[model samples]
Target: MTAPLPSLRARVTPPDAVSPAPTHGHPPLIEVDRLSLYYGAARALHDISFAVPERLVTAFIGPSGCGKSTLLRCFNRMNDLIDNVRLEGTVRIGGEDIYARDIDVIELRKRVGMVFQRSNPFPKTIFDNIAYALRLQGLRRKSEIADIVEQSLHQAALWEEVKDRLHASALGLSGGQQQRLCIARAIAIKPDILLMDEPASALDPLATAKIEDLILDLKQQFTIVIVTHNMQQAARISDATAFFYLGELIEHDATSKIFTNPARKQTEDYVTGRFG
Candidate 1:
């Protein structure tokens, strides 16, 4: 029989190996250099910066309204959708400035997909939900679409559970299954980075466990960035963790160190439940 999938712990690299700068290894896949964001007169993120390695899970963790989610949206420029928003500095993916005047927002979003806290499946069949994104990208052949739909579902770890009822309505699935369907749809277009904002916050314990498992398997293929308020969950899945507070990035390092021996008193307080 085929070997079972490895657990999350099996995939973690030691803390010493995780570094902010290039240390005889591949350069970061995503780089944020002194980035700051403002909503009108209110600054949502101060001068913040960090680098994210490819094919690993990097999590942003902090208390509510701490700008973790705001920074996550900056990766794909999701904040541009909001009115009166201004930004400074640079966010580069693969060394290209994402905010450059020549960049195409539509194509950028295609390369970097997002899954929100609440699962949102189209009001269509499970097969169609996955196929819809492919069609939007101009893949019209039924055979090609079918193949991609299957591949995406398998990547999201939902193919076997729904293969027999591909035509069934996605709305009929449980909250957890709907979230997985949304994940499958996001990957159907073959994006390089996956941004998850509190992806498991809406699910029960069992479903949350499944989502965490899927994240572990997915990091082998795609660069994953997530924003979560759950400190324990961050310790469990992330290779590196960044602690944000009051719009600033307070500390960023290997997940193990951030949890056990964070550099800042503020970070320690937040993680240890002394204060949010």
Candidate 2:
């Protein structure tokens, strides 16, 4: 099934993942170069250029409909799923152009995982939900799959909460737990990057704080790119912040500078709550 996929050992600890990734570099792990996107004839993203360092959090913030989510969708080519979507320029992950004719979209998705604004867990038992992908990939060894499930939940900071009820339906979980389960499911396959689209917007304050803490811890292993309307959330967890307005990338810089000493007036004004 699925061509036997990669062995659990190989997928669990990829070579590059084990290597220490420098936090600074020229050709960053994710590079968006002069990129633009269009829905039919309506342009959604302007020429957006940025580089995301490995194992760090980069936040995209702006007023609603400013194209933050649209741009985030580009990282994994999720936009291609929509009808009549046209993209210009390129998005490269690990130096390979994902839009290339020979690239495999399925394989790309395995490397770049996504978490949506709302958590959507499968109706199956929690254990089955995490193991579904493994089984589909021909991983028949229960011990191996169980190990990965436990590890993923631990990484998502969910092991302690749901470990005893692994056989229960995932629907029985709280919204926050469901969200963490979604995150655990995404990370179960060992994606190099995790793309989050307002992952904590719907959670309560305490739940949101847990999620924020989880994001901070997760950045040590996975490159994270998040789209958030809550500027405070961005400021709390992101290493860098990009400001988008009217489909344009107004500024992208260190979170500290973006908040305290932004180079762009537009960024300054937006961050200060003058206008979004």
Candidate 3:
């Protein structure tokens, strides 16, 4: 039998609480207002608006090529890597406009970490994989680095499995272990927002379940945004869900409502497995 769904605490703030004035003293952690993106002459996203609250899991779900990954990349300005990619309107993190000229993209990315679909661990040892980011920031204390490596691995739920093999090559790990190691690496810097782009898509079922459990556990300390095509996984893990269609935000609401009683007919049909 399937395990019972975990009791969902009321952590999602209402849409009105995410007003521009910051009502209830809880400002949104990330805000996208009338945001549009383009790759040279081709527009990818049109006028999308949403607010992601702190310390919660928000998921983006839709059919393939619906701009879910595109919008997730905008949170940390990953689109900047694409030639002539342009953004209109604003994407603000921690009340600071990320698109502003003076903003430091490197620091912005540090605050907003990401885990990609595949497990792309470095060729170095497991300990070095987790230490790579900390070392780049000029942290030289050996004791501190060791402590952080253990702490991050524990947070990612991999410490017990790999503690004895910290010196082993990361490339030798199983696919699931490598993916968890990637998560530990991302969390090592203690980012406030973690963006996952189909992070479990390449994993097996057991590995995917472990990643889902990690996502559920990590929300107490970090805000998470997940882009997923797996409807069941979205419903199981996310506190809130957003449905995108052809680069537009078709609907967004609580995960339960989105799955059971969506306000839009399109969202209902899609959730009911009628059509994407």
What is the C-alpha lDDT profile of model 3 across 1-276, one tens digit per residue? 111222234333233323232112434789988888888888788777788878889899999988999999999999999899989989999889999999999999999999998989999999999899889767899999999999999999999999999999999999999999999999999999999999999989999999999999999899999999999999999988888887877777778878986766667778889897
Candidate 3: where are CA atoms >4 Å away?
Answer: 1-26
Steric clash pairs (candidate 3): none
Across residues 1-276, which tens digit of lDDT does each residue of candidate 2 receive?
001223323322212211222235523788887788899999998777777888889899999999999999988989888999999988899999999999999889889999999999999999998898677667899999999999989998999999999999999999999999999999888889999999999999899999999999998889999999899999999988888887877667778878987666667788999996
Query: Residue 188 CA error for candidate 3 (Å)?
Result: 0.5
The residue ranges of model 1 lying beyond 4 angstroms of the native Cα positions read 1-26
Q: Give the lowest summed-lDDT range of ten residues in model 2.
A: 13-22
lDDT of 1 by residue, 93-180 (tens): 9989999999999899999999999999999999999999998898999999999999999988899899999999999999999999
Worst 10 residues of 3 by lDDT: 1-10
lDDT of 2 at 194: 96
RMSD of each: 8.6, 11.3, 7.1
Q: Which residue pairs in candidate 1 collide?
A: none
The per-model lDDT (C-alpha) reads 0.86, 0.85, 0.86
Q: After superposition, how far is residue 56 of candidate 2 from its true place, in Å?
A: 0.7
Q: List the residue pairs that clash in candidate 2.
A: none
**Candidate 1 displacement at residue 43 in angstroms:** 0.4
Candidate 3 at residue 261, lDDT?
69
